[model samples]
Target: MLRYQWEDAVRFWNSKKGEDSERVGISSRQKQKFTHTAGSRSFASVAEAEEVKSGQKVGRLQLFEITHRKKDGSPMTSEAGEIMEKLKDKKAEYEATASTDSSVNLENIDNRIITEVLGPERYSRVRFQGSGVTLTQYFGSGSQQYMPSGSQAKAEVQRLRDQMAQMQANTVE
Candidate 1:
């Protein structure tokens, strides 16, 4: 896996090495540090809290700190800094979506109920809207997908209940 990654990176680097090509100098240390802490939700949350405490309403996402160095341990070029900034912006956008969109609060719903009734596959498709506490089930394929409601949703829920009952009855033996 590492070999494949190394080869792919080398291939990418080589492709960018033309007369007019400006290289982005990213050091291994920076890469290691970024990889180590990039996905840490707790770290991001703490940083965000600290920013809020400092009276900043909205703060830049500190996804990764780019060290001003190149692949050869030289100073970073302007092109590299620009690239890193772009990367940071992209990461912030993704984190923003992940933190906001459909972060579930199964406070009133139990995991056992979900597993026994709806099954694991349907769990991801279920969105619990907080306003009216509506359970919107996205059904069918990508562009053709639609939310199930009214009689369709009721019938599906009933079917799941029946399945759960049958499973419980069998378990009693």
Candidate 2:
């Protein structure tokens, strides 16, 4: 796959079965091609052009990059403690701004998987805040949750059908 057209041409020229001229090697053909490349260029100029640079050094400088990320497959380090601290602050702020009727529990959710996997420190940080960067922007506290594939579709469709039925009932009679 990596072989080039010039290589095949050179091979064909070298291995002519019926022809009987004194054989020409690929290097000689390449030399001739290089010599005849441009008008007004001679063999001496060609020899000078092929000269290797003197005292060349292939020196190198080492470089590396560090990465920070979260691991979730098996048991991993928890950010729960840091999360709880921030959540408490956010809850207080929300409570102050919200009207009396807002039903935000401001309580820790009891999830065995989260607690077991993350430990108290990290498990405490994860909560179902509204969708946005607000929950993750401060202190880099970002958490993503996933469930069965069809569950979301089923739930959304059920909710929409219920809403449509309610709207139709309101319009009737």
Q: Best-fitting candidate, measured by lDDT?
A: 1
Point out where model 2 deviates above 4 Å.
1-148
lDDT of 1 by residue, 23-80 (tens): 3344434453223222334444644564677766322222223133444644355544
All candidates: TM-score: 0.20, 0.17
lDDT of each: 0.42, 0.35
Residue pairs clashing, model 2 = 79-122, 80-121, 80-122, 81-121
Q: Give candidate 2's TM-score.
A: 0.17
Worst 10 residues of 1 by lDDT: 126-135
